[model samples]
Target: MTPHNELRLLPWSGPDGKPCFLSTDDTGGPLSRLADTTETAQLNVGQEILGHAMDVLADEEVETEELRLLARDLATALRDTLRVAVSRGHRLPALDPSTPIEANEGLRLSAAAFG
Candidate 1:
């Protein structure tokens, strides 16, 4: 893995049993829990699209102008996600909609909810 600015180089076995490369971010949160079990970090949205771009650029696949546009779109998605996280709040429980929704039964609930 080679870290380049916000992108990190990732290597993996291709379908043909050869090594392939992808660009990723080491700092981003996991895209899924499954990836945590591998040497690869869970890919964020930007990294997922960028990986496709890497495949195309590697010349083992078709080349198209659309890939450049896709990379840009992924970059924007990552930037927006981070911006929203920063602007709205940082606590994890608040961000997750599945977290228990408790009523203001008493001061304890309020304290736990805010914390």
Candidate 2:
């Protein structure tokens, strides 16, 4: 069970595009499962947006409106992805200060690759 101060990480954002945290002890309850399912769907949509953007970019004569629409879609996907990532990060235990620095080298490398 989670402590009162520790809110459960939800997998989805609220209607206003804010991260949603649950203050429930039942982490494995029906509502939690539903949130998990919804999160999966949102992630899938993000993936699809990436694919669609790729297709749009590959076109020889993309219109300005098309590019604008793609940009909006990408923004939405990025927001959702960030929310999901933050929620998951909150659920993880803090890294020990004495742990080997090499443990997080992969994350740094990945971030650099994206950067």
Candidate 3:
């Protein structure tokens, strides 16, 4: 069992698009693995959409309908990215509020930590 504070925010939503979470100490469990895969896929999709949006913006022949579609995609990607950030950020090591900031200099953050 995992502590409530240690609960992991799932990569997908639940009923009514509400946030979902997992409570487990098993980081390598099936659900954990699924969430990891989902997060990676979401990030890849966001990246691709960002590139497409840039290309669309650079074209003089772009239509209003096409711009609408781009906006939709961008909104979805931004939501996914924010969710991933919140989930990963919560999992990061906490620093002592009273400790000198330099005492935490050894900590490093990377995508691999979340995945």
lDDT of each: 0.43, 0.74, 0.90
Which pairs, if any, clash in model 1?
Answer: none
lDDT of each residue in 12-55, candidate 3, tens digit only: 99989999999887878999899989999999999999999999
Predicted candidate 2 versus true structure: per-residue lDDT over 1-115, tens digit per residue: 5464677667665899676778776657898778767667778999999999999999989999999999999998887777677765666556667878788554433331221
What TM-scores do the predictions have?
0.28, 0.73, 0.91
Query: Which candidate, 2 or 3, would have the higher lDDT against the true structure?
Result: 3
Q: Per-residue lDDT for 36 in model 1?
A: 30
For model 1, what is the C-alpha lDDT against the true structure? 0.43
RMSD of 1: 15.5
Candidate 1 ranges with C-alpha deviation above 4 Å: 1-44, 60-64, 84-89, 92-115
Estimate, for each residue in 6-111, the C-alpha lDDT of model 1 and write its tens digit: 3221223458965333334443445312223232232355467667667667775554666667667777666544443332232222334454446322223334
lDDT for model 3 comes to 0.90
Model 3 alpha-carbon drift over 4 Å, by segment: 1-5, 109-111
Give the local distance difference test score of model 2: 0.74
Candidate 3 colliding pairs: none
In TM-score terms, which candidate is top?
3
